[model samples]
Target: MDYDIAIVGGGPIGLAFARSLAGFGLKLAIIERQPLAALARPDYDGREIALSQRSVRILDDLGVRHLLPPGGVASLAAAHVLNGGAKRALVLDPARRRRELGKMVSNQDLRRALFEGVAGQDGLDWLVERDVEGIAFEPASAALSLNDGRTLRTPLVVAADGRLSQTRQAFGLGAEMNALGRSMLVVKVAHEHDHGQIATEWFDHGQTLALLPLQPRQSSFVLTLGDREIRELCALPPAALAAELERRSKRRWGSITLLSEPFRYPLVTTFAHRFVAPRAALIGDAAVGMHPVTAHGFNLGIQGQATLARQLAESARRGSDLGDLRPLRRYEQRHRLLCRPVFEATNHIVSLYTDERPHARALRGALLGLGARTRLPRTMIGTMLA
Candidate 1:
């Protein structure tokens, strides 16, 4: 085998996985289709990732946390959830001992940091601008044929590709997919009023909105609506879009203007039928795609990659075949336990908030009220976020 392990993506999660296994002296290769320049200088894609304390700690360990630009990591003091212009809200923050809930960082920064951390690492190869055409597994190794007419072998293969993973499908693994029939419109906006580091999730009639606080007078507006309506909103001129956002939030930010081009993404979620098969294991969005409402997708991916890497490292240390199914199953079991409840919960949250019926509205109001009064649910949510 040319490499001990081959990661079939070069995104943050994939780089982090390779980094985790590098300490074990395993030769690694990243099979990425993107050009190295794009991989190295990731553009701001109007997406921000909410990093949990655990994720931050993992990045810190990987030496990637230091790459964050000043003012890029925003402190989230608390998150408030309101239902249909309700006077009351469900407030969730960190535990009593913590001053902040968590941190938020731009996706571009995270990807750049992760790439820089591993770009010069030993025993790792960058197979950039290359696509995996086929993958075949033997008893001792997996052989991957690249589109460039080159082939490489690795004892184990890890899939960190996004939700629609070609690698996963090539392995004949199945996924339970959900097309939520909704889309989210996201844009960076400059506001006249400061957000005070408070994030707001408003479930208004026929709309679900989330304002993620950024530095001072900046925030990311995430508007969830039907596909057709969101397409129209995405097509709106910046001025009109800003006006709509300001009106949607009831002038919470006083007045707003677009800071970046708005982008629209179909809100889809996926859960792989299995996390591992034979010499391969899945991580990141490939294993389970979460609804962004919970904002745990990337964090969970980072943590899950660590889980599988530890098992792979141990197998390497023991001189066992790295593709041995034993460790793969263990990693799968652990990750499944960690992600199943959250996946179900995120789906429920999406379903509940997106329903516009009167009864559903009343139920949402009552649930918000109950959540505000209940300590357990709030604490559970806080624990998940932090």
Candidate 2:
């Protein structure tokens, strides 16, 4: 085998997984199709990842947190969910007073941090601008054929590609994928009124909106609408769109001005039938792609990759087979337990809020009221958030 383990992705999750095994004396290779220059300097893609407290701790331990760009991270002090047109909201505040609920970091900054952490490792080989033409798994190892006519063998392989993972498809693993017709349009906008560092989730009849606080008067707006409605909204001129946002928001922010180009992301949720195949395993979005309504997608990815990495590292220390199904099964078990409930809850929330039926609305309103009165669930959320 050319390497003990080969990671088929150079994204943050994959890089973090590689970094997690840094102290272990194991041969590793990271296969990435992205150009090295791009990896070294990733572009700002308007994605502000709301990382849970646990995730922040993981990144800090991996030494990637300090590499993040200064002033690029924000604090989420509290979150409130509003159902339909109800004046009241299900409030979720931080566990402690005057402290943050979680940290919000940009995707580009995270990628830069991950690249810095993984680029200079001694026991790892960086395979750049390479495509996997084919993959075959065996009892002993997995053979990955690259587009450059190179066949690399590894005792273990991990697919950290993405939600629509090519490696997973090649491995013939099935996934439960839901392509929701709604499209989420995200953009940063400056407002006249201050947001007080509070995150707000508003579930309207035909749209679901979230306003994540940034600075005093700036926030990232995520508005979900039907596919056609989203295309029309995206097509609107900046001025028209700004007015539309302001009108839709009911001038709660006083007035809104577009700060960046709107980014439209189609809402799709996916979960792999299994997280492992023979000598291979899946991590991050490859294993479970989540709906963003719960704001646990990226956090779960970090946690999932961490779980797999921990198991692999322990196996390495014990001189056991890295390809053994025992540790892989353990990883899958732990990660699935973490993601399954959240996935189901997110789906339920989307359904309840998106449903326009009278009974559904009343039920959603009642649930929101119950959530507001409940302390245990909010406390659990606070515990989950960093």
Candidate 3:
């Protein structure tokens, strides 16, 4: 197969790229190992994603916003940050800024929306159940070899295969993984209380827990803890684990019951040494695996894909080779410049809040208090959501 762009990985990020490039007069093909039916299934329990206002704007521009399922999206109106025992609370109101803090939607819904949006778009092709075996870059084109002995040749290749991207490694642009020695236990639960579009995060000494409101009576809980603690939590019976979560959350939403089996994902920081190499470029987690505490991983991926699409479109319009080093460099520069600071700041925030030392705890409490009362810090946070 020959194409102008061949996108590896058909996850949300890759789908977003295809959607963004829908109207553009560029031939695009998305290759994925999973079939369309499998991708549409909601078997995975880790279904929630926090979508920032900026992310919403990007989806809106692609004409895929309305594809979101009914009652599957929740607007984040307020966020409350508590220190350990709930003695200190920092509340942020998105209404003050005249913009939603973010939106919460099921990961399945997001994938389905993006997939449907790209279905009939011109110059787009989705090749499912095609496992990539290798990628080779030539002087004029890049070729992807599939496990089935098929080859896809394109002028530009996008690696959105995720943190452990085979495409990235195949291109000799593997990332440096910095394990934070932590894992997140994620699950959905039925809350008795009306959370009313409120998202809450509690920072204890060893764990940072978030209760993100979903639809009418659902919420997703993410508990970040050390690997040992995660193992212990997972080993416990579902009832026991639910009890522990209720105790830790102070039963804020009344009695908590596990609605799904718990899952753990190792928390790590990964950065590709280079986002671009010859005829190839990396997007989303293939480029940067962000810490999930800031809830920016998927958001960053969406933005990264959007930026790449814009850059590629402009390059095509200017009669420049989309796969040229110069065009790829521009995409890399823009994404790195936008992602680096957020990455560093989120890492710092994790370190500070997870520290059990007396001084660190005191400082963290003070900072949280200041953030709640001061306009500057609040505005900075508002900008993140915006």
Give the alpha carbon lDDT tens digit for every residue of 89-155 in model 1: 8998787777887888889988988888888899988898999999998888889999999999888
What TM-score would you give candidate 1 relative to the actual structure?
0.98
Question: How accurate locally is residue 120 in candidate 2, as Cα lDDT from 0 to 100?
Answer: 79
Top candidate, metric TM-score: 1
| TM-score of candidate 2 to 2 decimals | 0.97
Clashing pairs in 1: none
Candidate 2 Cα deviation (angstroms), residue 50:
0.6
lDDT of 1 at 221: 92
Query: Higher-lDDT candidate among 1 and 3?
Result: 1
- Highest lDDT, which number? 1
The true-structure Cα RMSD of candidate 2 reads: 1.4
- Per-residue lDDT for 1-386 in model 3, tens only? 38989999988999899888876688998888888787665356585898988899998998999999867888887788888774757877664747568889988888888878888889887788898888878899888888889888888989999998988998899688898888999998887787888888888766788989987668898998889999889889989998999887778788888888888888878889999999899999999999887789999999999888988889878877878888789889999998999988988988899899999998988898888777765677677776
Candidate 1, residue 84: the lDDT equals 88
True-structure Cα RMSD, model 1: 1.2
**Count of backbone collisions within predicted model 3:** 0
Write model 2 residue lDDT over 192-271, tens digit each, in one string.
Answer: 99888889999987788899987678888899999889889999999999999988877878889999998889988999
Quote the lDDT for 108 in model 1.
90
